[model samples]
Target chain A: MELFTPELGLVFWMFVTFALLFLILAKFAWPVIIKMLEERADMIDKGVVYAQNAKEQLDNAKSEAASYIAEARKQQAEILREADKMKTQIIEEAKAAATVEAKKVMDAANLAIEQARKASEKQLRQEVSAFALGIAEKVVRENLASESAQTKLVDKLLNEVENKN
Target chain B: MALAALLLAMPAQAAVTEGEGEDFNPKEIIFHHLGDAYGWEVPFSHSQRIPLPVIVRDCQGSWHIFSSNRLNDGASYDGFYIAHGGEYSGKVVGEQDGVQYRPLDLSITKDVAALWIAALVVLLIGFSVTRWYKKHNMKAPRRWTASFEFLVEFMYMSVIRPTLGSKAKTYAPYLLTAFFFIFVMNLLGLVVIFPGGANLTGNVAVTLVLALCTFFITNLRGNKHYWKEIFWPDVPVWLKCPLPIMQAIEVFGVFTKPAALCVRLFANMMGGHMIVIVLTLLIFIFAKFGPAVTGGITVFSVLFSLFMLLLDTLVSFIQAFVFTMLSTLFISMAVCDPHEGHDEAEA
Candidate 1:
């Protein structure tokens, strides 16, 4: 019972002692300790914020890089397609040129063949006429055994030709 | 001759039971340990003790300062003595002509001596930490200073900053000091050895002073808006009209908050010490049965007391934290912007 009761002396001593303690510690101890602590806490907070910002920036860069890669791949495929189309067009143009050249060469060769046939035909006719004349003259010379018989034949052919005229 | 004199003195100073209690009163044992005394009896020894100084201003208006050993067993030294386990168990009273008046006993009793030791230790720690900061400026602390920094930082971040908000930076030093002081005292109380077992925090007067400090700071720094919120709260108009009951409760809360802080710390610490003493005393209480019974009881007593002491160790930290945390909370509430709470509620 007495233990629970508050005594004046103890209370006074406690008040004086605690008041002095609080003041001493607050003055001497706390300033340095608390300042250091606050500085450290602020540093930690700044560190976390910086880390988060860096992470976000990295993520953004990675996404942007992915999009860039995709765009480059698309452009590469388009260029390859254009080159393929141009290659096929060049092949078609070469084929058309080769056909026109072949046609001109065939026509020139046909004209040359026709002129040679005509010349041959003229020479054949003249040769045939000359042969006929030579044969007839021999025949006249031999059969008539005289010029009169050949002349009679010639005169008869000339009279017939003059009546027809 | 000295040796013979010491041997004689040893027998004379052997453990003397102060109270007239039969059957090994465990209650008396607890009271004896928990109460402030003029002497500190060394545990586990019979004849060794330290006699504290006794300072008393008696009815004669003159001061008598002497060794408290003169008042052994309620014996008077210059008409002053300490009564043990009575209506006036923990006081110094003077009897002159059958008139008893309480003396102003501002003496270095057991608890006072312990308080000085605790104060010295706190000062030493404070000085060393200050020196560390001085020696190593802007660099990270090392070793024990690092641990101390961690503790202070924890209090700053967890308790002070969150509660006090902007004012936290200003009040952090005082709050940290209060926290460390209580923490050291509680831990010191847990040590049962000669040098460390001083129940400084368990004393009501010490807790009261700490609470008083908090109370004063909170009330003194409180703004008009705080008082307005307490007196005329942002409640329904009818609520205010009803006998101002809400307002009265707020006023009561102001005082009770600090009172609760003091009582809570004192009771918890005192209770822990009592439980430890009582548990150990149970063995002696059962000793008359038989040697075998006494041996069994002693074993259980020692084990249970050990467990209690461990629990007390944990309680010491928890109570200290609780006390400091509550103090921080109360002060922050008093000083924080009242509109912030209202806005939060509205949102």
Candidate 2:
């Protein structure tokens, strides 16, 4: 019977003690602890989101850099090919100009040589005609010294002229 | 050492029985240990008790305060005495009109002192955890604070949060306090020394107050749908119209929930303490058969007591958890949305 009994003093003290504990805890302790826990959870969640965003941005930057490098390489190859083509065309043009200049110089030399040969041939003909005339005159003079020879020569000339007519 | 101890205890038992010419009575011995007293008893000595304050009111409504030792050995002080065997046995009684009557005993008994100690322990834990959170500002806890935080978080997240959902925060303070309060008392009751041996949770008055708190919180917070389900449940019209059977059962169930909560905790803790005391008493009961019987039974009794104490330690934790979990469920039942229940019922 005593075991089952609920004494008045015990009940009063229990209520007083338990109520005091509850009021103090609820007002001060629980709020702070639970708030800090929530704040920490929120902070961790934000940190994870921020990390994911940073990773995505890094990936984007990496791909963009790779594309830029590829574009620059392509441009470099195009420039190199254009320069090679220009070098070959310039060489061919220079060779053609050199050949034309050499041909022009050879033509001028041939014309000059022909003119020089013609002039020399004309001078030699003139000298040969003059010499032959002078030799004939000397022979005529020597033959006239002998009177009889002169007369005979004149008659032979006249006879030849008549025969010709 | 145990045989020597038992042999030494034989003289004390002989001395007690010699005065009364009676054999050892285990019932009175167990009850004395299990029940509350105005003074704390020293181990191995019944006469030497640590005096505590005794505040009592006479039948004429006059309050008096004095040390409990003044009333030792059937002594009386200022018309007040501790009744030996009567309707008010073990209580401060006063004579009125040739009739025995109990006073308004607001004295701090052994159990009340232990209750205050348990409350102080809970407050210490609460403040320590609070201090850590305040200083660190969301940083992790360590050592005792860490273990305490783990218990709180586990209870909140697993039991309270799941059942109460959004309303968990509203009721968390009371629920968490109850959990720690009961758990601390249960653990304190397991110790056999100063500030530990009082059976606070096993006391019916203490459990009644705790259960009443749960009962009031549940019923006070009950939604409109809850009352409707209780009074006019979605049952056959015949049950409500003719018999009112379901309504009666629902109303009965509302009171039974808290009642069961009170009795369950009280009975478990009380039974555990009783069993330990009973086992220890076995040694004295077997002492008459000779030294061999007494020594053998002492070993058996001591071993069994140790085992039971270990078992009670686990039961302390489990009972606290069970009480808290059941309270959370009951509160959730009252506060939950009607639609969720309707869906479940249909499924």
Candidate 3:
């Protein structure tokens, strides 16, 4: 029966001790611990979000860098092609100019040789005509030493002159 | 192992022989061990005990305070003594020939001292957790402090939060405090030593106070729906108006919740302690046969006691969990919106 009975003293003390314990803990301890727990959870969530943003930024930067490299490579190829075209053009122009210079030089040399040959032919023709005329004069002076022969030749010459006129 | 068992069983054996030269009465010894006292019985010696203060008022209405050592062995002091053979047996009584009256005993008995010790232990745990969080904000603490954090998180998240939802914050402190208080007391009762032997949780008076706290909190915090359900439940008009049968049952359920809480914890703890004491008393109970029988039974008794102590430790944790869970459920039922129940059923 005593086991079932609730003693007044024990009951009084239990209420006092337990009530004070609950009040003190609820006021001082629970709030701080629970707040910290919530704060930690919030921090973890924020950290995850921040990491996701950083990864996205990293991905963006990687793609941008790849595009820049590709553009740079394209520019390099364009410059190389232009340079090769310029090199071929310069080589072609040099060959053409060399051919033109050779032709001009050959034409000038042929003109000088033609002019010299013409002059030489004219001189030779003049010299040959002069020699023929000297031979004809010597033969006419020998034949006039005879009078009869001179009268006959003078008549024939007059007749031939009249006919020619 | 056997030597340790004997050492652990020594206190019960010593208590049985303290009355000296009388036949070994296991019932008296068991009850003495179960009951609260003014002095703490130390092991291996019953003539001397750690005396506590006895605060009493005599029949003359004068207050008296003295050390309980003066009342040893049925001794009397200043016309006040421990009554041994009456309705007031094992209580301090006034000097009278018959029908002596009991004084207003406000002494710090073994149970009260044990209560104080248990409260101190709980407070220490609370402060230690607070200190860890204060020192290193979000960082997890190590060792026992970490375990304490796990227990708090587990209880709040799994039990309290699921039951009470947003109101978990409001009631978590009381529930958590009750949990650690009951748990520490239950564990302390299992140890048969100076600081650990008082059966605080086994006392009906202590559990009554605990249940009362829960009772008051549940009723006071109950919302309109809760009261409506109790006074005018959602039932047929005939059941409520003609006999108030459904309403009566609803009202009965409200009181029974807390009553069940009180008795369940007290009886479970008391039974555990009683079994251990009875098993230890077997050595003396079987001594009349011979040394051989006594020796064999002693071994059996000690082994069973060791097993019970281990089981009680587990029971301590479980009962603490059960009490907190039930309290949370009750509070949630009172405060929860009726619409939520409908939504849950739909889902």
Candidate 4:
């Protein structure tokens, strides 16, 4: 028999089989395929959403961490600066106290030395005056014991008193 | 045999003699059997040939547009002639002709008519089940609906969705059309017996057109990334140097990819058809030799053809899937951003 000849017999039989098979497949097979497709689409969509959400959360976390680190560094710097200032102030106060204490010790030493020198000078002067008085009394007693020497002395003294008057 | 007798009776003088039963050559038999004295005819002259969508023919000196399988019964077969080139001298069919020549017509061709019927049946069943669900006012899907729903979900998750992503919904119609079209064509090949046994999927022209559609869509929707890859690919200096040569080669590669898509599908489908037909022909050849040979060859041919038909049916679905997947891959490449990674790094 020639192939591809258009015979109603072949055509009719083929049509019937085609219809039967198609109906069976549509009823039994196609739905299953379509349902599977829809489910797969949903799963993919969910995955995409999950990924996006994860990415956003990650970004937020990173920024938050960066900001927190910056703030901590700033606080650390401030603390260091305050500590430096306090150290300098303590050193300056210590130096000033040392200077004031040294000044007071020097003033006390000068006062004690001046008082000792003045007392010593006063003693020396008194001793010198006593000695001068003793010498003068001794001289006067020797002259008065000799009568001639006493008269000459009284005349000279009279003449000197008259001339002086 | 009846049909052969009818054809032989048509015109005795022009009739090509059939070889003697035992001496019959299979190739000669097939050639003579299918050969027409008048080759395909078109009405337009050489000057009038313009590449467009019309097939005009001049048959027996009558000028007419060669339309195949028109809706009208007798008029459907009247327009065109299919014959060997030496037997008849008419006009050669080409794209240059103002008319588009479709080699196969679904409405008129016997096997395609069967396929059309099958498609209708599939559509009807789907509608009926959906209607039943609506009538019941069920919140959940009924048995038939549920089965279909599950299949769709499975395909979406495993196949379509993964390849195309969330935007796959936008392409669902085309994907569905491709799947059903391939499935129906495969099924028809199994069931129908008519001219050339109607291997619709086997037709290279059909596959070429389908591949072309994918190619166009991929290119049309291309983003910066796709073009960048084509025009200025990020390759090593050794590969990228000699700008003109690499650029030319890369551009050619883009076109070749789609061409491969067309050729692969066409070759696979046509190869399967040819194998099945050749095997089936063995039965006739054996019958011509002797009855003893007939029985053995017939059994083998039938079994082998059946096995191949089942395989072909599966292959049809797989081919459609591969085609769609490649299409999605190409389009995704086109639409993806070139600088996305860099932007992410900066962020």
Candidate 5:
């Protein structure tokens, strides 16, 4: 008994209003709305994908930069090593040249000292021979002054000369 | 004015004096009336009386027989005390242990309180859902918004899209709105959290209105093809002879579809409520005379009631789906061009 009571007027109006509203919505509103929603979703998805790719690219670039920096450091160390080697070679060559020059100078001074000592020794030998000859001459003159001794001395001298001959 | 004067003069003569014997408590009588008439008492003991034929009011100030014992737990008061039948008139019994109370006068019991409670629940649910929507941004649709979107998608894909085809997107808003509205309303009927104890979906008027809306939309949007199929048929000469009769019947069929929608929703919701009420009443019927019977019946009632409640929850969703599906089917049929040779060739 409680189930079927009718509110006739309300039922009529509800039908009318809903019919009008649905018409307007179906014709004008729904298509634009759904399209907009789908577009928005697609845009967001694209943006996210782009951001991810950019981040990956950024990471790659950072790694490449780090490698370049490392390579530069290595090249700098090689150049410094080469410079040190060149400096040491130049110093060694100069020292060798100075050593040769010093040896040449020492050889020349030794040659000059040898020549002077040879000349001095020759002159001293000649002077000593002359002094010996003079002393012998004086001794012979004193002996000849004794008379009988003179004749003997003369005969001895003759004998000595003959022996010498 | 006449009625009021009559009421006052008649009641003045019947006033009772002190020491004229123990007067019945009018408040107890009123409470008893509410409990007995519609089972509005609090259900404590299983042996308590089960109220039958509960009555309730709606937001429109209309009275209706909401459910039989089969659909609702007879109204319980203060969480106990199944109301027993009574009608008594007496003076105020004064305060008893600091609790002030009034006696009751003889009157027929009504269930306006129960009806009010049901309305309040409907209002609360509406408020809560609206508040939830307003508090959160739906542009990006997070959490609950996403959940609602999925639900809307499911309904569109499974129901409207298949039926309406090219026009499905255009019909999605109406279909989705109707689905949610009916779903929420049906769910409200199953939960009893209001002051009095009411079931809004049990009311026939609401179902009728919803059905009427579907009816108008279906007919208003009908194209030439729909009318042609109903009013004329392509058949052999012999069949064509009786075409007029068929056309007349087909015209009636148009109205019947929406009528069926109304009845289907109303009946299912009302039927589910009745079953739950009856299961609850079983406890009182079995336990009225003894504690042992009462204890056993109480357990049985609780289990059975829970089962029915679960079924009602499922039915609420199903009814909403069925209504939307049928409406979509009707609209699609109306808008489709049956005379198109392409469809005929394909078939």
Candidate 6:
């Protein structure tokens, strides 16, 4: 078909028309359009970067705060442990002091008891001798009237006294 | 007589398309529709039509300009008649001293007028957009500016960004312009009502010129790596041998790529026009049987033609998009760095 045929004049005109169209668009239209695109992309990218930086800073602050709390908790535990140890030492020292005081009181009481027991024994010997002497005097006065009884008793007593000396 | 009634009824700008008898010549009607015309045919008005201005240069290099009605109204003025048959059939021919010489018929034919109309409209739109950008450069765009900006952004991403990548910024001006130009031309072709329905892209001359531009840009800017890849592909030694068949095919591919791009657009667009014409012509074909048949088929014909028109509009936009995408793809392939090509192979 002649429909597929080419015409030179029309071809030439088409070239001229198209070239003019292209030139005008390229010069007037494209730069502004492209710049707008570039600027918008840059804006989006900067926003993302800013968001990421903020998130990172927030994360850092959170971690630091957690570590601070952890340190505070550890200090609290150490203080409690120290208090517990001090309470045990104080209890043990108090126990030792009470034991010493009790032993001193017991020793003092025992010495006093020993002193009383010696004194009592001495009094008991004195009383027993006195009673024996009284009885002997009474017997001597009443029975000396019988001469054989007094002489035999006096000789045995004198022999016993000489052996004791 | 049936063909005359049918022709008068059809709302086409084709000047002369009638044939003899029931064997109606659809070719004459179709070609008349496709070809340049002297005057636009107004339906049901045999003596009345919209006349185009005829401009022609004589053998003496003198120019004659007049209304096309003079040539069509059963008359020839100053020895020049719009030829009705043969290769120069719708063009003006001058009978200079007994020799029928075809002068330089440089009239603003139907498609040429359409092209002018398209160019002016595009320029007006572009100027308005530029103004809008100047005033509201900082704020978000509204109305047509928003849609236009969106289109620009889409081309930038889909065609420019993927193909050119980093160098997209550099070639954005040309790529964006080419996209809009083709899109507008195709869009105008779909408007059957008013002054917009002329097949500019269907003309081989126009598509050839467009393809030539792509060819020039692709090759002129084509790097050494591109040419090298064409000549020496990464094939086995045995494959590279055997009369350099692969290399020859690679080189041939470069030329055919643009040819294919232009032809595909032209054929798709022209095919739509043909189908619409044939569908409408069927009613007249059925008229030969009886008035009953003609009346019955007219309703169906009108409905199918309406459907075709809607589909044609969609095709127009799609064709424009395809042409722009392929042209950008070719340019990208030509100017891409060797490493980019390597990356493609790896991918």
Candidate 6 local Cα displacement, residue A163, angstroms: 36
TM-score of chain B of 5: 0.59
lDDT of 5 by residue, A54-86 (tens): 999999999999999999999999999999999
Q: Residues A1-165, candidate 1: write the lDDT tens digits.
A: 655566677788777777788788877777767777667668989999999999999999999999999999999999999999999999998888888888788878888888888889889989988998999888866888978887898899999999999
Stretches of candidate 3 above 4 Å error? A97-165, B1-7, B10-12, B15-22, B59-61, B95-97, B288-299, B340-347
Between prediction 2 and prediction 5, the one with superior DockQ is: 2
TM-score of chain A of each: 0.63, 0.67, 0.69, 0.61, 0.62, 0.57
Q: Between candidates 4 and 5, which one is better according to lDDT?
A: 5
| i-RMS of candidate 5 | 10.2
Classified by CAPRI criteria, candidate 6 counts as: acceptable
* Model 6 alpha-carbon drift over 4 Å, by segment: A48-165, B1-24, B40-51, B237-242, B341-347
lDDT of all predictions, in order shown?
0.76, 0.85, 0.84, 0.54, 0.56, 0.76
CAPRI band of model 4?
A: incorrect
Candidate 6 lDDT by residue in tens digits, A19-90:
888788778877777677668778889989999999999999999999999999999999999999999999
Provide TM-scores for the models. Answer: 0.73, 0.81, 0.84, 0.50, 0.49, 0.71
Every model: iRMSD:
1.7, 1.0, 1.1, 9.2, 10.2, 1.8
lDDT (10s digit) by residue, model 2, range A1-165: 888999999999999999999999999887677777677778999999999999999999999999999999999999999999999999999999999998899888888888888887788778877887788788887878998998999999999999999
Q: Candidate 3 lDDT, tens digit per residue, B60-124?
A: 78889999999898888878889887787788888656657888888888888889999999898
As a whole number from 0 to 100, the lDDT of residue B223 in candidate 1 is: 84
- Tens digit per residue, CA lDDT, model 2, B310-335: 78989998999999999988888898
Off by over 4 Å in 5: A1-47, A91-165, B1-169, B192-264, B284-291, B325-347
Write the residue-wise lDDT of candidate 1 on B28-121 in tens digits: 5566567777777675454446888888887768998998878876688788777654567657778889766678889887777777777777
Best by TM-score: 3
Better of 3 and 4 by TM-score: 3
